[model samples]
Target: MTRIDSLRAGDPPRIGGYELAGRIGEGGQGSVFLATAPSGDQVAIKLLGSALTGGDDDPGPGFARESEILRRVAPFCTAQVIESGLLEDRPYIVSEYIDGPTLQQVVEGEGPLEGARLRRLAVGTLTALTAIHRAGVVHRDFKPSNVLLGRDGPRVIDFGIARALDAVATGSGVVGTPPYMAPEQLEGAQVEPPADLFAWGSTMVFAATGRPPFGMDSLPAIVNRILHRDPDLGLLRGDLRDLVAECLSKDAARRPTAGEALMRLLGARDRPVGFLLSAGSAAASGSPAPPHIPDSGDAPALSPGASRPPPGAGARSRARRRAAILGAGVTVALASGALVHALTRDGAPARPEATGPARPLPEVTSVPPPATTELRLPGLGTTLHENPGDTARMVSFMYDSKGGSNHYARVRGTNRFEAVAPWQEPLPSPDGTWLALLPWLKESTPQPYDFVRLVHVPSGREYIVRLTDKPLQNFNPAWSPDGTRLLLTTFDLSSGSRTPVGFAIVDAAAAKATLVRADTSGAPAAAPFAWSPGEPAVALPFGAGPRAGLRFFDLNGRTLRTADGVGEAAASESPFAPAGKRFATGCPGAFASVCVWDTATGRALARFRVPAQSAFIGWYNDAHVLLTDKSADPHKVVVMDMKGEVLRVLAEIPREEPGENRGTFLFHYMRWS
Candidate 1:
């Protein structure tokens, strides 16, 4: 039976006259729900989200195109589309429900399928593709998760990005998943039936072996292999292996069509209904028992260039037109905060003038709580053993092991530690209500894809902020003080080496992004460090090569100010002070000092030289700066006053041995609201 998650707060109770039962699943474009029809039969409802179509009320041509494409495709081995309409402005489709786990889930739980089962899946999915292509529609996105193993047989689902054959030649950017995408899709070329065939081949590899044919590590490596190298088929053997290899050919023109591949698998033109699929050698092969017979429909030759005039709608270009549909709602929610704040606050002590010779530098102190192995936060309260739970303020600390360096989050004020997502680093928002997941920060190069995923800490609801219309690896994400916006540095790596593209300012609440292309001709490119607390600008270290000092950039890519004599502060949560009056950075050249600069004047205000190997860790408050003591074992997070005196220690954490090639081990904190 297919598992359905309870509906979230934002999910609609009903759509197009059907009462939604619960959520079946969610994907990049939208969420799918199990629904009850008026006739008492159960159906599946899909509400397109993200940038799929126009405003909820409009249901633009893009939505119309999707509905028409879904309606035209034959339902022999695919989910049959029942109806599609606009409900409360969002366009949704109703389709027949398939009660079973996805191919991905099944294979992951029970390992690879054997002879008859694998062969049936291939034939069934290919039949669906043949019918779809014959109907003048292309299943642009086909992969393992899209294949549902129904009790009747395997059904191909989710035509969210499908296009009528006539619209395939438009200027569509990369649209499918990286691993299963063909070379043509990666290069943004015209997609035809061969692309789906390529995906089918890749999905087969996943079913035979629990991984994509092209290794699924970094996006750049996967894309490069898809375009240049041959696929690793693993244990896939015999005639199917050769078929998949041909289907995965780099040259799309060389791949076999759905009907041709189907014929080759069946080893005949067309088998009769209920014909023994596992006869002779197939029975002797010791594979699983023969599954239900699929539609032995005639393998009609599906032409790669088949086409017909599309009905009253455009292709993905219409999606671009509706990109800002959700922008209005987000803008209204984030309109409260002021862009810039005054550096000084009322009742705050003013910085004393540099009068007598500097007093003796205060000795750094390390204070451990009752437990040496656990770090504690005063106001964090009791600990809860869950991920990003409400009322749970968690701090993530890194530890090194034989496998590698990974992060584990400890509930603030308690000794319990919890695991978040694996392989990705989670940076919590300022308010601890959201978490941004990205590739490990140690790697200079990012995975390089389209968007940044921000997960709401309390509800675990996820929102995706696309960096640009096209693919660019975005990195160095820093949350704004209010946690409503995020700043990221973008890079273009299609040509191999990472090249400075620009910066992207993302409105986390709005799911909208604006790309600002800065001048990269003068100084070497630098990652953005922090957002200005008072204004719509960001801090980036520009004191390198031909340029000197730390550069401040406004949202429009214009330089606001450049403070000389200081560089980027390593390990700093943020470079800006809470009051937006002063910023912190490392003194230019060496571990000599930490400098504080006036935000308004871009002038150095004070310099503090104390403990060795100590790095800046943002402002402890408006008047004091936080620093990490890493010169010795059992590192400590300490606070320092404006008078170059170490006031006290915040937390003392046990230091773990750094793994081979794993960079510095550090701790990060997120305060719960």
Candidate 2:
């Protein structure tokens, strides 16, 4: 049954002296009722379904197994199992009621969490997993629905299907949801803790993308995909990709243990080392701030009057403080001296000298440019403007079609044509190193599009990256700044309607693809619009309505700032200048204007208009701008200097008859070399 179908409503009157107030949830094995005890505290009473408890034809021990596992693990993780007894000829177990919605509900309603919230969720979930694993139990069903975001943190629930590590006969009849189940589970192999790791990977995917990795409609198909298919990890950010990759490794031994996973979730590799070094420095400097050694128990309290010392005390007081600090420093040094002495020990670099009084953060202002220019492309029947700082040597390829065939041709010296290829759909890499081609009949019977070939410009070597068996129609293949990843938006026609499902990021080096997010109505996914130069975060464009704009997000899907509407309002490739201080965008149509926007604030700084309609914009050096305009007879190429003054008329092509317009003139796709 589907998840929604399993849920039961209404109260069951009474069960084992507890009054059932309402029905909370249900699953294939049992039904959970919201009930109250004599003390008025709430509890969830799970009653085994008739199918599992045993029908008239047979008697089974499903409830017995659940009770045993719950009793064993109650002390370590999950709600306290208050009692278990027979009610209405069926065994039921009551657990402490947890007040919160499931992780699945949260993601479905609010998309994904970011920044501190995402980290905290990961830590809490891993901690729960660690507790369960230490109790010698494996929670076979660990989907998002089973994880509740409690008032304090996340609490892992639904251990009803949990099994002992050594148990041989647990009556495994394909337990757990197929999308979240591990490959081994699909193979009906003996389950282990690694299975939970696989589940955690799926859970994390759901948390990040608001959906499972595999997009299957049926249970059987999902099961098949999980057994043989590799999960798409394109959308995951930062260290999450590597961590999730390790957790979902095919081999159980390769998967990290629950404890190791927890440490990774807590960023132990970065945190513990930094904490130790800072604590050491504080003690050596004679600071009263005690070393913070994080433990698995309650935090230690500071003694009364043990407040922080003033920043600049007198020399005599400083000497006394240093003596006290030296004593405390020696104590810590002796205790940790035997520990692994690594780079952070005596070899640590000395802190740099502080500069003159600290300066305030710079304010970002969106300054409009002084002027704008319009460009025209006669061959491609389009007009665009050149962005600032672009060199005149760069070229742009525009889509051109004639005689029922699609091709891309660059505008050469003046109004000349230089044919690159015979593909109608073309997506160029940011650095112009590679080109992604899509060849499909615009109007034809629907078919699955399977492969994307990436061709290196210089060597002409092609690599086919296959995403799925279904026919694929996609556009906008943008390369990440490093050129290691390619992001493409896909359109799936299998559902009869055009569903702009989502985008996938393909690791160019590995030739593997992973789905990042799904958009039902063809809206753009929250993919990074612009990658930070030599940094991990990308300027992501998102939000709804007029408030929708751009913000910076780190690789781990963490929002660095909600600086929406912070740049020129234009669509597609907002190529930043060399200094990254400015960017340019094209405004289409008759009064085609190119506007330069200041990156700091969302303001139109400058605007320059051309004689014809404009389509694309590119910068040529710091002074001249190349524009494609379609208004002048014999469409013209207009060149403008940085101050918006007309520098030169690069070229002009005579207009051709409607039918002959295909071959008379060619437009160059402009790019900076």
Candidate 3:
């Protein structure tokens, strides 16, 4: 009776000698149902869905062989297999029903588990794994979704993909969730009992933190973290943390065996333990980490005008700065010279306790004290400068080096300094706290997947903004001036054609996106997009196409206006000015000049001619702009006035002629406050 859904239409009332009661769950393998056996005992029935058939004429002799191996597994901390047979030519396996919810369900509904409960889960699953391994079977997929919280104790279930020890142990194909898979499994190396131990460690981390240890960012990012970066085990303290870390070791040979891990868990306890609570009995829990939106299903509606500040926003700002280290590379100084902390736990300090009754305000303060202003800077190539100057402390930029292309960010003075996912471009939020990334995949062909990945730099929390049920391809992610929202263009690929569908506005904090479906027939392949600096309107190349100039649209995707006077432009810098009164773009003509346009009327404001070699980088301020002066001898980042005047130089760049600083982009990209 633990969280069972009623049987749906077309579901058989009776299979073999068992009567179906209700639905337990459905997954990649098949649907599971709660049923009563011939002996009138409660049992769980699994309708086979995997391709494990030996021949078409038979209902999978492989199923029988696999079920025999599963039956050899001791019932200790495992679901005991009762029977296996072909019912109506569909392969099925029956096992003793464990009345409980999955660990994944518990964590998602409640939060993370801690202390003794956490220890018990770790112990129980390891016990089940030990038995499975001793029986010569390797549970290939041992994630949170597999561990069931039964009334007796935690029981491991669904070994549909398990392979016997003597079977073909290695294959080119990889099966299992990306985040929970071990390094060897990902590399297509020989997977053994050690891989299960690694999964156990990952599950333990997920149980304690309510997040995958490597983070649930992207398939590429998760694979990168699993292979390279150390896990972000949030607040998993003491001896348990050490054991889990050892289990998660990248080297599979170094990871303890299932039996060895069981011994470690059992031997560590100094106090006697009683029975653990069933999933239905345990109360929901919460973590000290920042609240995260669920990954699946529709996200909660975002509150209007509600803003979530980045971590370490208040008094703990300095502490967070001290802990800002690159993900896996050279450390950078945030405060003075301190090691960067992992993005595992909340860096915010504990709130102070109330001393006594509240006191009345003495008098009206002169004016509220100004907010704290911290220094910030960007890392050019492998080196980072501590002097932030007057630039915004939170900034995201890309630099290419011998190590390859990487995206770096300085949030509240901390840098996601290491290239978590190499060759990816990250667009920083206006405040420089959150980052919107289009995670790069090394696939042979273009994918139809459409979703924007957002990461809170301070806390290392990640969320996805999904707009549609159908597959899509998103491009041009532009953050609003306030950093609370994002504007992106969506493409439909249902007909195997990449057709321009419409645009979407994503609520960053809420992890929710609204699709403004449109008929973009005349839009260019790559159109320039931007959110209005003042109002909620967005300018995009709509159905009328680039010939229509900048077409403005509201949240409902209604066309507000079309400024044809702006004309067709090839934008090389940010289109909108900081003050929102004026915008700039590279003029489309043989002369190639930087043209300023009025935002309200879209009329030409001013034109500043530039050297053909020099390119418009971005707006320096409302009155000035920045240009990359490659025409200069040393190559400089120069500031320019609205008029055709070079005001001052910002930074002089060292030229890489041929043999010098190969594969390094030093000071090639720059941004200011």
**Which has the greatest lDDT?**
1
lDDT of 3 by residue, 1-673 (tens): 3788999998889877999999988876567899998788999998855343322455446557777778887775788788877665456778988878899989999899875457667767877887788788888899998898865457898764445212322232577888889999999887788888888889999999999899998899999999999998888885668888998999887888876666444332223111111223221232223434333334323224322211111111212221221111211111000001111111112222212222222222122122233222344412322333423222444544332344454423343333332334456655444556653221100111235656654445566555443334454556666667777656543333335566677777677777675435566544535666567776664333234466676766667777664544433113666567777655534343666778887776666666555645556556665565555445555566665567656544444444322332312222322
For model 2, how does the per-residue alpha-carbon lDDT over 430-483 read when each residue is reduced to its tens digit? Answer: 444454544322221011223455554434445545543232334445556445
Candidate lDDT scores, in order, read 0.58, 0.49, 0.57
TM-scores, each model vs. reference: 0.43, 0.40, 0.46
**TM-score between model 1 and native:** 0.43
Model 1, which residues run further than 4 Å from truth? 1-373, 376-394, 397-415, 441-448, 469-471, 494-500, 520-526, 545-547, 565-573, 589-591, 642-666, 671-673
Task: At residue 264, give the lDDT of candidate 2.
Answer: 47
Which residue ranges in model 3 land beyond 4 Å of their true spot?
1-394, 400-402, 411-424, 442-449, 456-460, 467-471, 491-500, 541-548, 572-574, 632-635, 652-673
Ranking by lDDT: 1, 3, 2
Model 3 is weakest, by summed lDDT over 10 consecutive residues, at 331-340
Backbone clashes per model, in order?
7, 45, 2
Q: What is the lDDT of residue 1 in candidate 1?
A: 88
> Could you tell me the lDDT of residue 347 within candidate 3?
14
lDDT of 2: 0.49
Query: Against the correct fold, how does model 3 do in TM-score?
Result: 0.46
lDDT, residue 298, model 1: 15
lDDT of 2 at 404: 23
